[model samples]
Target: MTPPNPQDALRAAAAHVSRRRFFTVTGAAAALAFSVGLPQAHADEPADPGTVRQEPFTLGVASGDPAPDGVVLWTRLAPAAFEPDGGMPPAPFLVDWEVAHDEGFHRVVRRGRELAHPEFHHTVHVEVDGLAPGRPYYYRFRLGPWISPVGRTSTAPPQHARNSAMRFGVVACQNYPGGYYTAFKHLANEDLDAVFHLGDWIYEGAVSATGGSRAYPAGTLPAVFNHETVTLEDYRLRYALYRSDADLRAAQAAHPWILTWDDHEVENNYAGAISQDNLPPDEFLVRRAAAYRAYWENQPLRRPQRPRGADLRLYRRLHYGTLAQFDVLDGRQYRSDQAFGGAWARPGGDADDPARAMLGERQEHWLADGWRDSRARWNIVPQQVVLAERRSEPTEAYTVSMDAWDGYTAARTRFLDAAEAAGVENLVVLTGDVHVHYAMDVKRDYADPGAPAVASEIVATSISSGGNGAERPASYDRLTKANPHLRFYDGRRGYVTVALDREQCRADFRVVPYITTEGAPVATAASYAIEAGRPGLHRV
Candidate 1:
């Protein structure tokens, strides 16, 4: 059967949605609307009455993009998550939310109401403000008789305040069909200030009836997920399938998340508007628009993160008092196309071109300016790809991944140069995508063996993507030998926890033994630390 056109699907969804529900307010109008709160209605008096059945919060609740003053709380009214319309009516539904100082909600701090419009897949993102900074808060949603699971979130410390310590979890690359979300289950229990998810939240491929390695019952997942995602509805349903995982939901509820997409959220190894299959830019953009919109709908992001067609400005900076500054980057969105036909190629030609950009020209400037303006103790870069150079062949002539920073040599040099010029004291880059844990020294010059390390990079392994990985994969020895800057490597499935203080930053690589089965135990594969003034990784 021929697949439905993405543009047509988007247009059809838009046509069915009410204009009043679709239109969004901005500036003073938005401020007034949110400040006064949305029109409140009981579940019985819903705009589309009698449309909801079962529990509407099957996908669960989440919080994210924390600030000193506020955090965004998110939930979607999806009684049937896998359905084309998420089993909701074509009208808006009222969702009530409250923030409390305690999980039991004996002391309420903030309360408001928002409309969950079908135009946005019945999703609501409530940016709750007017709260004390650097304190934990519990929140939940109320839709008539049903109440969402309580979520824990916290605001960052005041901008100039001197924070003594901060901790966060780094995770990425969770492909649903490949394995279970056992890593997320473990991550849910970790004590973290926030979680940085570096993308590949969902794969864009088809799923088997038995749910691949998960070995679910033959008819467990809906048949709708057996095909690759293409349309807005397809992407929306895909997110629903992933979000249906209880472990993933638990982690999201446990801590506020700061997320950025790599590839596989839309398509694998996509660069800018270019797709891996090399489809026409216009056609690819339509699919991208669908993916971006669905991503925003499902995520706990603020209004500015919303997509305008295929474009979404995802790169931004967040401060944790004066202790750390997180520059969450969107590597897949603005990068130049991979050189020499992409992936595992010997560097030359376009790879050496001085004009090749990884973060785009505008973002490069923005990053440099941010570095110059930053006053935080540690400059933390939460990005999608590996920043340090990795040589696959242990020889003078080595091959590297064209899809990574190695593909843009001049751009990498410029980045290091900018950091040096900005006088960045402690630079720590947190990365995900390689599906293996790696602690490497970000050097000013990879060719110079004696060059001083300029930064430290901690690459977290996948949450589940590569199945049950070995302690040392086949390429482990060769890659580590070829790249002297690499301090440690582990091919395991799990997340990483980084703790930062006045003197040093330490990263603990936490790994689960297996993900193909349930109830796997987690262990610390390795731990590394970087001193405040030092850049290289030291085994701790």
Candidate 2:
């Protein structure tokens, strides 16, 4: 059916409401849409729910932040996803949603309506509650005659229940122009209960019209995407482009995701409110606010994660009964500026300053408190950046990545100390953002060669970043030799699958050999098991 013109719909709706009320509502939404210098939409009437003609669910559906009672269902009305306003009029549309026990809506448990507001890019975040725990549910969205693709999600077990096993996937660093999302296609087929996206979800760099490494034909992407993203509309359009990937949409539809951001979501190697290029704090904050706002609108995040200016409270906890407790952290938002100028560098006195924090003081305290109260068998910390120290030269020179936990020596010590104080026996750190897979033993003291292992770290490779990587990069041998705690390392494009039981946590390093072309087969390049009470990696 031909869709009703947005202008016509607005004119029809204007006849129903007082002119003052119509302008009051539509003006507010338009103001928000153009807040970051995006072109203003024409002043119009309130949206009529029945007038929506185009299919609004072009970006597909997703579920996230699954609780014991329910999960958050998400979708956006993006009939013209590439457009700055997502092709919707500057108004609100009432969206209908349903949660069902089966794929078909015959066994629906809950159904409701929510307004997709233009102020939030017409995205819907349905925090559905009052459902049975530890069971799967199907969800979909509706707007007039349009229906979203069905998404499958499940809740955690009862808070204190003795859940035996929990399996999940860890992924990160999906640079849209770098390669195809071949790994995500394979990941979507995995038997995972949930997915932990450890940030760098979208790169903020410019995309060539040819689409970088994948090399799409000329004119495939718009000229607007050829420049760096700084404004709210820019970030939103970038997400729209990335979400257009079928593999990514498939993964989101297949399982719920828990996510946090790394530097590239705003600027590469940025720290806190500081921009990498040293832009003034106020100027950088404006950009950060835009990035954060677009991030929330695109992802399957709840209202609690919505951005308030440049600030967003992303660090939080999730429990899977007695099996595991996931402390998803935000390493980029509140961190101190990278010591000795970011990226690979030698340590300096500032790197060891106790006052400097990776998670900031407040979030550090929150994480420690959560650990003290956690009753789960395995305490999993899903966060951005590598937690273990990797020496560059495999010698005593002490060259390391200032962007990672290695740069914040005292902060790393504080984290381990707090975990130890809280009696966290089975600690597993899930990390991303180096574009490589690494299995390392978290040492009590990196300075001491004989230090005991305090925890285990499983770092997942990128979904498709750094192109198709090698099994062993040039410095692989040196890195392993330098850090004795480093058990395994691989440079490939894929994700990591983790399974936790009462006895042990197993990590399978899944890899796809090629991403420049589509349909690459995925395989487990390596596997390691971290036994409970023994915080170290054991090849299996």
Candidate 3:
């Protein structure tokens, strides 16, 4: 096989973003929507100093994958109605960028400018190097006459570098058309070292009524909300609508983020060859391309993930000193088709179908290899969707959500078994996409409900997309109770906060009262802890 281009997956993914019309953010709160690309310097903005704004960028700012000597900086120039379908008329201008040691820009370190116009969303990414490791720094942009707000970012200590511990916020499934992003706002204020956006950042379709029980309608609700999304315009619209939220942008600006995607980013239960919606691979590729493109342009991913076509490989590893090695997996692109039935799918438990596959053949091997080499005391697998064994009752209840690991049991079992063989220590699985919260004891045999627990799973509730305070009903409760391995479950709208010490990793399931309205209060729905070396999780 040809060596996979480390950047191929992301670039292929970004091609989906419509580059026809580029929006420019010129004023405060101008409607926001845009995309990303490599450094393209403009002539309008003269090279200037730090912490100053000559031009205003409305989409805010963010950073990601910080290394001791380098970091990825991101910001988009958005104009009202920024869409590739001739939404925002193109305007040629220079976009400038700078990074400083202080908020005042008094100690200038790295600075460069990029040229941007319509047709690529005018988003510029600067991968700065020659910076100290494990340190925090502030940066901003200079657009024509206004400067974007100053944003803060940090660098990752070398894998072997030793020092104090670090903190990061875990978030996922913040679907648009559901509610506000108060959880992101809460995290934005906290002094977090990083944010792990596991997946489902945006539902890849129209507004959802699936949120029904918890949904607050903009006008009226769709009976099904087929909610088709394909064009570059649709994806751009979704990202613009999502980033328009102040809290989301603030959280992005607050810390460098590490990311991975779950199914909803494209559609529900999208396997490699098929989508839950039953679209062909070629047709779905059109949509997947758009989704990935918009995702890259909107976030702080490095230069590698820029739009290439309709595919963006999202699997990668992040090492934070000797403390941890985060093996972020891409569960969608190469996953197998969802298991046919639902809760009633089957009970004989033939997960060893030998035919069904999850994580695909390559990702499974990659994960196993990664685990074999994991040097951290903690091996955190931050990903999108369910990895835990779900023991739903013997009913015909099936979710079209084939995107989850529950939909591909054989592949999952193989991957888990491989991890077991790899001698991977402190295997902690962090996930989003189920919309509900669950802490499960990964087991070797689900057929034997009493199987010994293997790894630990902490499934975070959605950031907002679980609708407003939705529950999985009491019947599902029976499923958890029947599964001895599952320690906790809650179907609410919220986020998860993880705090790590020298010995254990504690996960706090932070739930918000409501996302339909602003200024909501947050309470811990639940929490779980895993001791180092011991992969099994226990309720705290």
Candidate 4:
């Protein structure tokens, strides 16, 4: 057989970094290698940097990845976000952060000073601890006398504590240039315990005027923001552009976010270290590392999730008392290169390769173990792509997008089988990417003519990725008819609001009528529920 292509070979090699090898790597050596690629430091903060001329907290503040004792606070000092250096001199600045029980900071619980280093775009990530569990807190950052907007976040309940109900707002795929973030504005208004961002938080490509409801002004398109992101600066600039949106900022401040990335955060349809343009492994790995680093710096994630070399540890578990257990997974990093060279491929042949994986070996094992050991009432997997099989055409001979779960039939089967064998009764798979909303019953064996539905998959619509979309496209109607397991489908821009309890899980498909303009009203396109015992969706 012809030697595997460079990308495939590279993936195989990377997958060999087993748990043993990962633990054996010296922390000092890893840190030393990681420090080499950091951008040059700017001047250290002087006693006073003269009259503070820049508004550093323009991107606003956010908190995410909440645990019972602590949550991660984030704010980047970007006065001019679109600029290469965010218009900051190379320097380390002392930024102060406070967590208070009240919005007025009258009862300050935790306060600290952190350095906003130039290397990470002067972003400060504070992992605050020693707070009450299952409670809300107000937080803000300060630079000199300037204070950021006070944001709200809550800690998860103690791991084994019993809680009656929990609510979450699921959002994803907000392409900056597509339209305004009216969806986020509405999402901020909802009363939610936390938010789960499934991925594509920022698209890495330049904006075009032809496809969106409203287009960015020509004057606002800086040279740095108009091209595909390849370097660290480019990715940082892309995130800055997205973070500048008022609605996006509001959504971030409204609740703590659980974040994981899909392809657009780096490039469209990229698999592992493979680029869409098919660049060499070494060259593409450099770009991958840059993307990973920038992703870490921009989000409200803890230090443990920071990128080490080209690897970022994102797949982990979070518990919300005894109500639910969240297995936030990373699907892009360790996945095998898409079959047919990352293009549309037939469902047989290489697509059936048992070695082909979406979560690689370690993460797949981790998820299975989590399923077996979970004690919460609900086991929710917030992941990147759809877990159920979806075909571009109805026929078995047709092609499917190899970038999704359909590309790895054996792996998907193995995972579903393991989940079923684990007796996971209340398993729910939440997904984003594909820019549409879908509610499907995840079959234990899709290939079996009489396969049983073992789980429910609710796929959220993009925040604004596909511009203003239709409520019911003709193709969507046909798709639902062809796949009986698919209960609901909509091509629109919005998100899914879910409430879980001991009895059942309720999902509301919230959609915005338009996105090209601002202040568009949101409506519930449909509501679905999965009872405690039954796995399929019951329309409400």
Return the lDDT, model 3, position 23.
Answer: 16
Among all windows of ten consecutive residues in candidate 4, which has the lowest summed lDDT? 28-37
Runs with alpha carbons beyond 4 Å of true place in candidate 3: 1-56, 81-92, 208-227, 341-344, 347-351, 394-403, 447-451, 470-476
* Candidate 2 structure quality by residue, lDDT tens digits, 304-359: 89876667899999999988999999998878777777868787666776766799
TM-score of every candidate: 0.91, 0.92, 0.82, 0.92
The per-model lDDT (C-alpha) reads 0.86, 0.87, 0.69, 0.84
Where is model 1 more than 4 Å wrong at Cα?
A: 1-51
Taking the tens digit of each residue's C-alpha lDDT, what string does model 3 give over 283-312? Answer: 556566667777886777876666555557
Q: How many backbone collisions does model 4 have?
A: 3
Error of 2 at 107 (Å): 0.6
* TM match of model 4 to true structure: 0.92
TM-score of 2: 0.92
lDDT score, candidate 1, position 393? 77
Worst 10 residues of 1 by lDDT: 29-38
The whole-model C-alpha lDDT of candidate 4 against the native structure comes to 0.84
Supply the global lDDT for candidate 1: 0.86
Worst 10 residues of 2 by lDDT: 11-20
